[model samples]
Target: MVTLPIEFRTPLTEGDVGALGVLERDGIRFEIDSGRLILIAPRTLWHADACHRVANLRPYAYGRQGMRISRTTVRCPDVMVLFAEPDPDASCHDPADVAIVVEVVSPDTAVEDRVVKPRIYAGAGIPEYWIVDRHPTDPRDASVEHFKLGVSGAYQRIGQAALSELEKTG
Candidate 1:
């Protein structure tokens, strides 16, 4: 819950237009926006573990590195699978090379995780996006929701399953 102070500013936008600041503390990540220095919330152990499990199960290279989807959109997804080998020196992965983006929801970022992030990913033309919710209304269990980008720069939910079901089968 403690974040080390760090000023991470990117000059991606036109002339003197300050963009983003990233901070990580205690395995949790945060982003500062509009000079407000708000916490972007860190991931829980359960969420982090889920990210690792997904990356390990994949047949390709993946990581929790920062992804710069657009000039105004920078995110560090829980897990990201790249289309090619990752550049070891790169600060952020190119959205075009990214295959999948997975976000595990926590209480602090529920709204952004479920709504805002999806819109940004879809706008960037990410092929697939996954939302793993630790709390769900039905059955009182975690659930995973899968979304595929539609032609109109929007996401279409394709499938969903409970975490318990996934564990039993996998």
Candidate 2:
């Protein structure tokens, strides 16, 4: 079995969060929520279209930003939008501050995105989560899966569409 680097498990402090916020890449400093840091990767045309749609929705959406939840610091997703009330008693991060969470599925990280991340989001009480799968025809495409947390502690599929469809709607 191959071992992935254990970098995601690093603990972070408020001071570290400040330092990370100033670390720039290609002229854009990343935003650190707790410990997980996010950087916006180069987007495909389809991605741009989807982003445009998401932007018009007036959800206070953010792309590539970290969200601090509980003890584990989750990496900022490809896109996250806030549509609800802000939590007053939030310590790690405000659950109510998050509305929709989207992830563009990559081959290396798809499983974690689908399996692991949803569980965390549900535990944090995030309401909506979207998983954008780039590969529709590939046999390995697990990308079509979209998961939303029910009142119970489980995820349910909401919608599944191609990248082109997502862009067109946006």
Candidate 1: tens digits of C-alpha lDDT, residues 34-89: 22333455556777677766666454546557666545445667778787776677
Predicted candidate 2 versus true structure: per-residue lDDT over 48-68, tens digit per residue = 555555545445676655576
State the lDDT at 32 in candidate 1.
25
- Which regions of candidate 2 deviate over 4 angstroms? 1-10, 25-58, 71-74, 84-93, 135-144, 166-170
- Clashing residue pairs for model 1: none
Q: Which ten residues in a row have the lowest lDDT in candidate 2?
A: 1-10
Looking at candidate 1, what is the lDDT of residue 1? 43
TM-score versus the correct structure, for each prediction: 0.72, 0.64
